[model samples]
Target: MCCLRRKKNKQGQYQELISVVPSVPGHSAPVIPVSQGFCARHGEIPFSLPPRCVPQNTAVLRDAERQEKEKEGAMKVDAQRDILAHRGSLSVGSWYPVGSVLTGLYSMTPLSEVVAPPLGMATRLCFSVEYRHSSEQLVVSLLRLSNLLPRFHSNMTLVELRLLPDDRRPRQAKARGTGPDPEFNDCLIFQVSAVCVLRSTLSVCVLSVEKDGKRHAVGRVLFPLEGELGQAGRVLWRDLDPEEETQCSELGDVQISLSYSSSLQRLSLVVLGARGLQLLTDAGVCVQVSLQIHTQMVKTKRSCVVEGEQDPIFNYRMTFKLRPQHLDDACLRFELQHPNDNRSEPPALLGVLVLGPFMYARGLQLQHWMDMINKAQEPVRMWHRLGRAI
Candidate 1:
């Protein structure tokens, strides 16, 4: 039987070959069959044998098949690249058929995980409360007290959410108060500053409007944020208390009066005195008053320092020539400070009084001057309460 044999040529490399046959008389060449083996990296594989005459058609056919497979693979890789490029443009919340197929390739990290903790903390703290009203009547039938509202009715009620310690503006959610079993399903969002999460309180106030168009506080609930940060989907019910009210701790009081003259176009601030000052230092206390017109400091006045007295009496008057229309953008600031003999120490802040939009009206003019003062000489004087500085 004929069998393939291994042999080597002058280069001294192993080569597999069919046994040599006798020379043919008509062909004039030795009849030898050559079999080719492929090398992956190099195009052609070299064998340790002398070149023998063979048909080229078989080699050409094998090359054609290899090129066809390479073209098909290149097309598939390009298609995959385009699909990934398009997938990157889609938002996280969006879904597509292609996205479903490529789910394993995309990151599964949530949006909160990639962002800051404060933003995630705010989102986790926000929740919805269901309010079930017990009364459906337009007006309370049992409210017969003279001090109560004339015709108290609640068409709509809103809940105010105040996240404390940072003192950001409160957030509110409203619902229709129509039926006896009306469910508010109101979503309240509160952004808690990260610095105060450990020591903050969440106060919610429920307010309803009366027939006289005045909104009155009906109930309030306060929640302390001890360790309730990670609880996102938990629902808690807080019964509203009609007698509850959100009140700030009393700091101190200052006496002041405001007057505006139309003819002179001047706004006068009369600082009569400050009583019951809650200063921390034993040093004498002095009051510093600054008037800002459109957030620009226009005038500043300091009171005479009282020696060893908490309640400093300084009849200091500061006036500014301001346009009547500027009342919309003007604010009066009063800061209490201790007069320090040591130049190295900064002035200690006792408390501050800020008369903002609630105290003054934007439409303050000669015609609207009646609302400010009942009579010309009698400037409206009141004991202004001091709170934390803005």
Candidate 2:
């Protein structure tokens, strides 16, 4: 039989109510029932279930990777096309994209061939001139050079002074500066005779020296000494004339007579004389003439040495045996040489002259050669200008 029971709270009020079943003497506890056939075949089921395995699709991933590679290849091809289009147009300081890398940063323009224009500048010279009666010497002072044009490469410059007709000795002074205007506070002195002082003129030339030891005349100016400035020196400025227009007095001039004999197969060349030869010292100077066929020198002759003379006379003659056929390829080279004081050093070359056919000659030199050929046995005499060694 069942019975109801009531409990009291701490506040003296009825709290919980319960129903209880009365137990009989010697009774057991209650148990839950289960199916015996299912329990024997399988284990008991778990409260939660495990997740299932699923297969993945790889084709979609491969397609996406191929598309990415194609995009990269297209970008590379476009970069190469742009580089080819610009090519040499890219300046050294500018930057541009090369393939996938950024090279320089500037505009991309098509490259084209360009030619550099010839550069030239008007030059001026500042100098002072004076003649000392007591010393019987002419003095030239080079102050400075202005408006000099910069060369494509670095070079050395010097000023050369010569007292014309009477004194042809070259006196040079080196200039020093880092800019277009150079300073040359240097003096040059030349001995002058009383009779020739009034008639003498000062020839000034500016020469540029290269690394190969070759000298080129840049410009020149001529100053006469007839005025009162010869007694009391005066500073003056003069405009330099172009090398082509101005006559180079330092190189001097040579007179020669050429004749050929067809029957004897002989060529006769006479070394008459040379005047206005510019020398660095009072040493003896001689003229050496050589006959060259093609590249080999066949014969050579030299004139007598003359000392202390601006104009030297040499009546020496030379003859070369050659056939008419060889004339087309024959060339004559004349060199002016002076002995050096020091035995250790070689002889110095003053000037040179080359005469031959059109291939080896020009201007007066060519004209002289043609006249010798046209006139045959008749002697053709002409004056030729001397120049630095080729």
Candidate 3:
């Protein structure tokens, strides 16, 4: 059964967390019968514990009594096998499916010739902005909005102005939010340094802000400031588009331990168990965990599959030598497949989890990760969520 815990957030809002526990002894809990198989689309099953088997006695007994005992033993074994089959069906077709910390303004692009306006340069550019129609995918659209909010669609949006070369922090200017094809008669201004007028370029970014105050850039345009900011200021019109959507799915989770060696510059990962798998196979599944470092070239390490078990206990340890400087470019990817040699069919991908050290270091699990890094020699065990390939 699942346990629910509740707590109040800083804003006095209540939130819930769920955890599961084993069945209680001697209690008759509601259970889904093994006869009824699992549903592929909806993985719902009544929770129940399988019955224990009775052992046979060595002492002599009446023929009728012995025969009856043997029959009961067979029945117990069959019941256990039925439960395993049900669990396999559930594993083959179950899915309990269901932010950003910004560091300093860094390089958005990698062209060396580009330079940002010097700090403390005082200059202001005024803009009359509007958001026209956007054909971008819904998911990507939420990411590229002028408002800093995440939503199905945004009505309130604004533009943030930045002077390129990226050494200086960029400032934001907001536009009034409107519905689709929203028009903003409101004017916004950005004050930048004088150097921004010389060799630096102007980057106008469209942002979308939610009621909760989260925002992201929808699209941006780069304008060369060579001589555009002369005596008379100029008004320009621009349009932006969000990038394509990256594919993601709620597959399951894998429990693993991580440790790093500062002196040897090596990282060791211990695969523990992958739970909540939803692979469709009669012979069970295998998991493949790999790590890749992308510096100038890509380096990779792959682990052998944990055969015969859907939710396998690998206890496999893999290590890689990685420099602290190259940590940002590293990625860990996990996959689940059927252990087959038929060669005729490719392995099915049950689910996957891909993590980039740099980006994920700031997540809620940051403390656990930091501890692993700081203690270098100590390994921290954690459960990481799995997702579909992009």
Candidate 4:
């Protein structure tokens, strides 16, 4: 879930940013694409997760899994994709294989591109980006592995979600939420829910929106967990004006941009915002407390230094090498700092993790991932529930 709250500017356009790092985190673990299961259409794609087998002991479960893999018996599963058209006479749609992310690794599909629709096809706007994991066997291998053991069969329900606006309505917000109201407003917030099934041995890397766009800086809002809300993961966003630039001014100047990724529901931020003058302290984000999750693990870097207060948005970044070692399933969580509370200051939530990392089948890769997971101590909790079905 992503939470974004900031004052609107004179031009009705504020700054936004999103960044990507090397080591992957949360359920968005970067995994190799190896399989291709079935072809997908643009409306609603159906898929399923592999079943669970409760082994009495750890050794017993491992042994049974080994034997089942050796037998070569297979489970046939399917997932479909939907093709969507935004404008003009264009052939645009999302592609999917016949299987889940774990099972799909066998067909050798090379992921080489980001996701976007083509240009010229859409009227005044166009975005055709595709992030490819593998070039070959994108879905075929997922078929083979699904047959061998308990795996995940995912049904991807695709939505042609866009940060669209209507001209008939005023695009700007009222003065400090007091003046005349604007007609058309999509402030990038909505009720949402998600379910992930990861009860298997295969792993996949999460391709994030910030990484795909190669964006430099971003605003990260951590959502709160409240049961009555019903929907928690759905999000909406608007593009910032292209004219504004952060020139290291004294009045606070940072270009804020954002990205959305289907794989990782939480918005991953790119750290590179403007550094204000040292005299002015880093302006803390006036946030609404709503962060929720079961903390399986979390690692981040935060240091305070300001070049000037002219820019309130100060950027900091930390890299976390993650791997899920033990799992009932994996979930990501963002927690608020207690000390920041009180002092007329609302606690800021950096992130809320919905999913965690999964590793590959190869021995070397698995070993490396296992090492990373072992470092994170358990007994952590954020808002959990997304991993139950995955």
**Candidate 2 ranges with C-alpha deviation above 4 Å:** 1-248, 341-344
Model 1: residue 251 alpha-carbon error in angstroms: 2.4
What global local distance difference test value does model 2 have? Answer: 0.72
Q: What is the C-alpha local distance difference test score of each model?
A: 0.54, 0.72, 0.52, 0.26
In angstroms, how far off is 384's CA in candidate 4?
23
Each candidate: RMSD to true structure? 19.7, 26.1, 36.8, 38.8
Candidate 1, residues 54-142: lDDT per residue as tens digits? Answer: 65799887898899999999988777667757756553432331433466767566423433223121101223322222331111001
For candidate 4, the clash count comes to 116
Question: How much does candidate 2 score in TM-score?
Answer: 0.37
Best by TM-score: 2
lDDT of 3 by residue, 1-390 (tens): 345577888998876575354444565754543433533333563465689755485353467688999999999878766665554433322232111223444535521122222233222122422222242110001112222223425545766454444323334444444543333334333343454336555565555567786544455565665655443322443344342221222665677778888789888888777766666666666667666665333444445666554467778788877788766566666676766678688777777765454454333134334546555677766566676666
**Considering TM-score, where higher is better, how would the candidates rank from best to worst?**
2, 1, 3, 4
Better by TM-score, candidate 4 or 3? 3
TM-scores of the models, in the given order?
A: 0.34, 0.37, 0.34, 0.20
lDDT (Cα, 0-100) at 371 in candidate 2: 58
Error of 3 at 120 (Å): 56
lDDT of 2 by residue, 1-390 (tens): 233356676887774354343443443443222432223223442234478544376787789789999999899888766775666444334345333334567654321111111234568787777777789887788877777768712667877676664442357788775357667779888888766878877878687777786656677787877874644656677888754554545788777889889889998998888778887788888889999999899999888787747788887788989789988799899988887779799778878998877667764576566658766787766667898886
By lDDT, is 1 or 3 better?
1
Segments of candidate 3 deviating more than 4 angstroms: 1-250, 295-297, 360-369
lDDT agreement of model 3 with the native: 0.52
